[model samples]
Target: MTIELYTWGTPNGKKASIMLEECGLDYSVHPIDITKDEQFGAEFLAVAPNNKIPGIRDTDTGLTLMESGAILLYLADKAGKLMPTDGEERWRATEWLMWQMGGFGPMLGQAHHFHRFNKGKADYAEERFLKETQRLYGVLDKRLEGREAIAGSYSVADVATWPWAARFEWHGVDLDQFPNVKRWYLAIAERPAVQRGYSVPSAQDIPMP
Candidate 1:
């Protein structure tokens, strides 16, 4: 059975879509326009009580899942790919995944919120978040040094972090400054599946209400 993916075009949503594409899973997308408050709708809330994008309903297991990181891990396990089953490699992949979920993602999100979305300039907040975002990017850049992918391979860690990193410019990141990350980013961006996944839910398909 095909998976039912509830998502949008944002980074979190792209995570699920990319994972599905990477896993070669058959799935259908249900676009959720969070900007229009569609995520809070009773129907969407049934599958995602948290009222967040990137939820999924796996018909094969009759399981409903939320949180982009969890969803990626679940899909990786379900497919028996994109993640090591056990060993240091497995833990390594998981470690970076957590780092992304707990640190990189949230920090960059706040940076984008303050720097781009804020109507009234919040100078202090913008500066704080942007600096933190840069720090996190620096960490990622160092980790990518002498490596092609996070956790040493293209695993769920890569899948989870790729979407957010793709918006580096929006987060005030200079690709030239983080050459290693830029290389990794460009490599991932060239994947056909990643390309298709990033294009999920065309902007014309979901109008803000």
Candidate 2:
């Protein structure tokens, strides 16, 4: 049975779609136009109480889920792929996932909002978030100094964070400044499943705010 994916094409939304694609899961995409406030509708709120895009309902198990990080982990476990089964490797993956959820994604999101979308400059907010975003990029670069993937493997941690890094230009990031992240980002971008996932809901479906 196919999962019903309620999502848009933004970073968080792309995480779920990318994980599903990587797991070879059958799914149907339903675009949630956040720009039009579709995410706040009661129907969507039933499954995603936080009124966020990237929720999913699993037809095979009647399970509904929200939060991109949690969804990625669930899909990874279900597929028996992408995550380490036990011990240090497993915790390591979780550590990076939390790092993305708590810091990277949120900082970049604020940078995007203030730098690109805000009506006025909002100087303080813009600078604060952008600086933080760049700092987080540097952190990732240091972690990837000699590694191909975060957590030492292409696991859900990568799935959770790559989309955000992929939008470096939008966040005013120069990949050259973070060469390791640039290398890792380019490597993941070449994956066919990632390419497909990044295009989910289609470009035309994304509405302007």
Please list the C-alpha lDDT of all candidates, in the order they appear.
0.88, 0.89
* Local accuracy of candidate 2 as per-residue lDDT tens digits, 42-112: 98998899998889999988899999998998898888989999999899999999999999998899998
lDDT of 1 by residue, 43-120 (tens): 889899999898999998789988999999889988888999889989999999999999988888998899989925
Candidate 2, residue 184: lDDT:
90
The TM-score between candidate 1 and the true structure equals 0.95
Q: List where candidate 1 sits over 4 angstroms from the true fold.
A: 203-209
- Root-mean-square deviation (CA) per prediction: 3.8, 3.2
lDDT for position 114 in model 1: 95
TM-score of each: 0.95, 0.95
Off by over 4 Å in 2: 203-209
- The candidate scoring highest on lDDT is 2
